[model samples]
Target: MKKILLSAVFLFSALSYAQDVKFGAKVGLNISNLSGDVEDTKSLIGAHLGGFAEISISEKFAIQPELLFSMQGAKSEYSESDVDYSYSEESKTKLNYLNVPILAKYYVAEKFALLAGPQFGILMSAKEDFEFSENDNGITDSGSESIDAKEFYKSLALSFNLGASYSITENFFIDARYNLGLSSIAKDYTDEFGNSTSLKINNNVFQFSVGYKF
Candidate 1:
């Protein structure tokens, strides 16, 4: 990612400097994950749709900020290790949020800039499910014991971001960034047989995307 940042700085420098603050919109893809007690081994492609503004501080520096609707989460498998038998199950978690990122851009050339900042996200929705075991002749154990279907969004998180951006032209740019969650998402859980439990959901995010200015 640092390599990408370096390249972005050079690209921005080669472009012509603008007198007015630039404003535009962008839509791109995101590869995300959820960290913590439950391992999010599987990563899914999500979307980043937003608009941004660039106010030139000088010939080589600017304040860049954006507001976007981002979709993120993780996919994983669960199994019974505490039970008498061994079995596995699969699950998917989908989290939707409204994210705001404010960054400082340092130009290396003219059109390429290095970007870093703090990103704040507000939770909108969270959904999850578990797959059933393949074995038969046993009672269907509801995974509820391991998962609490309620109070999930109480985990809304905040994170720090470091990234890079490129201006393909004076009106369009593409950016890539990494977001490290600063908060932990804790949730109430119910075990299979009937047990109350708690698990901490890690909010770390690895994101890469492209955007354009109007």
Candidate 2:
């Protein structure tokens, strides 16, 4: 990322001198999940809040860059049964991130625009809630674990976003977007047997938001 930051800075400087520059603030809901090499996983509900600048390049096009704090992750469940015993487990992973997205927006209609861009995310925190239950010969046992999950996840993630925004008025708008992760979210390491193993997981998130321009 140094190159990305440099490019953002240059673009921001160029756009700052343009006409029709608008600033806005937004808050949104996120439905996030982990995809690839994982089973029994479901979407995790989260939130994101941020600010953005819309720099007009022409009558029907602009560059929108945003800084956001996002919460994302997934819920998972696993179960197994044998003739004499049954076991079940559930887990929820929480990942917090600071995200920057530089989007190119094209006005498709008078009040609607399509947006697509690359987003870079910096992981802030990771945690998990785990619960397990077992039944053997009519006896049952249950337990729970709260874990710090940062060690299992990578520090940075890259994703691409595609979405649309509709303007409700001159200053109010609504947005819907889907982010598809391009980088593996987990770290690579060697196992006890000197074999390399890594969890190949990527983030998938759907976002909906409302915004007001200032």
Q: Pick the candidate with the highest lDDT.
A: 2
Per-residue lDDT tens digits for candidate 1, residues 84-120, read 4557777767777788776778998787778887666
Off by over 4 Å in 2: 81-85
Candidate 2 is scored at a TM of: 0.90
Off by over 4 Å in 1: 1-19, 78-88, 133-150, 187-199
Per-residue alpha-carbon lDDT of candidate 2 for residues 84-117, written as tens digits (9 for 90 to 100): 9999999999999999988989999989999999
* Candidate 1 whole-model C-alpha lDDT, 0 to 1: 0.70
The Cα error of candidate 2 at residue 63, in Å, is 0.9
